[model samples]
Target: MAHTAEIQCPRSISEEDRARAQFYQLLGTLLSAPPSSELLRGLASLQGDETLLGVASRNLAALAERTNPQDAEREYNTLFIGVSRGELLPYASYYLTGFLNEKPLAELRTDLMARGIKPRSNVHEPEDHLSTLCEIMAGIITGEFPCDRNLISQKAFFDAHLAKWAALFFTDLEKAQSAVFYTPVGSLGRVFMAIETDAFAIQ
Candidate 1:
């Protein structure tokens, strides 16, 4: 996903929403491009708790500590970009319709338009790209878009655009043969998707 306008959360936002937005942003940043040396170093410093998500985070941190930027970039290219095509096509349209720029993407664009969230002029990728979707979700939560900044709105968007396919994509990421440094990233995404699904169900 290409970079969008930066979003700053209001101080009145709840801690839970703040954390949720941050996680979405992190996933967006990592998946949009390979981690830089500075990003890798920062990731290596992360400490996680005892929960499944935390365990995945800790695992990611350990892997980051052992990974250099060059190796990580090579791995990223192998997993997401290759001589022909990468091991995975990480778009909702591809995952759901087995093709690029299908109905899912059209629907997402419509939703985004309604929310007053437009893609940057230079962005060539479809809005349904997983990384782009994550960034949009972060924007919704952080009030960067015109939609209501509440759980109901988040749930609607998640269920429509993400719930159908994101976790499955993450599972594929975890099992991909080219995965190394990204293995725990997949785990973290899978676990976080589950958490979000569960949390949304109760809302």
Candidate 2:
């Protein structure tokens, strides 16, 4: 779950597509594990404009500036890795089916196989993990997969795996009592998911 390989795009990617991919990558990285000191510093340097997502980004950057790695780790563990289970389960299967490793995970694995996308051998979690799905979306946008790289393909994947429940998960994250550094993360995700849904609707 911690390993992600660099993918060289086979074709030219537009700046907008690149930005979208980067956003997905950022979300995936933040959710996959606790932020390292370096990551926290980098996030602190981020700047945003007047857009809704930009506001959320700016808020996150502000929080990142005040957050130390140790506090961030503790917050992450509380939200995702408590004694029995975390405060929130960041998995699509659980969100959609009230359980983990159910039909949604099976469907995702089948789709991933069809797209020639596979999880790293070291990852023990199911493919339905929100972080994993976000990473896969980033890969698709950046032409990392063998399939066609277009809005149509992206929409298909989004509708199948994420459109159903990502916003709800983000909302829960935003409201979780253990959240501090992750509050803006949830806000950003919620806003982004709405934007994506609207964009995909028009396509």
Candidate 3:
């Protein structure tokens, strides 16, 4: 008879990991769709300290307070969905390979499969979409999947998919002509990505 071995359960995620995951999730949520009135209201209540990232967060909240859902929706459409293509394309493949659904996207898909990550049935965007990638990072930290969800795994995924292109994209977004409510969002992203990059480098 063959001997069976016990499978050790994964360790519980730390509080710091949970907070980091929530930040990624927040980014994913904000980028995934136009901000609803409730979301805008929540944004308007955000407060921050004296640091650069905190200042950016405060600015975002201030902008959110002044922005209405109708205007925000229009801005979203203009920035992300123009008549054909938006001013900016938020895809890893496009940023890295200069084309949609290119090699980067294919590589991301392969990795996602290897990690047993399946996209939601209703999600039509490729796995390399910025929002999708953010959500994946959050899931990885939260151990939403059975695979490796350690700090090393989180760092690997972020270094590969987000660290290179996400900051550039956010910088573009901050300066885009159509950006109003999203400008502060872009600033926040830029600062957050820099922090994440630096933190990961030191680890």
List CA RMSD, all candidates. Answer: 1.7, 1.7, 5.9
Model 3 alpha-carbon drift over 4 Å, by segment: 1-12
Q: Candidate 2 regions off by >4 Å?
A: 1-9
Question: How much lDDT does each candidate structure score?
Answer: 0.89, 0.90, 0.85
Candidate 1 residue-wise lDDT, 108-203, digit = tens? 988887777778998987778899999889888878776787889999999999999999999999999999999999999999999999999999
Look at candidate 3 and give me any clashing residue pairs.
Answer: none
Q: What is the lDDT of candidate 2?
A: 0.90
Best by lDDT: 2
* TM-scores, one per candidate: 0.95, 0.95, 0.92
| Selected candidate, larger lDDT, 1 vs 3 | 1
Model 2, 116-173: lDDT tens per residue? 7767887897888899899889988888877767999999999999999999999999
True-vs-predicted CA distance for residue 131, candidate 2, Å: 0.4
Ranked by lDDT from best down, the candidates are 2, 1, 3
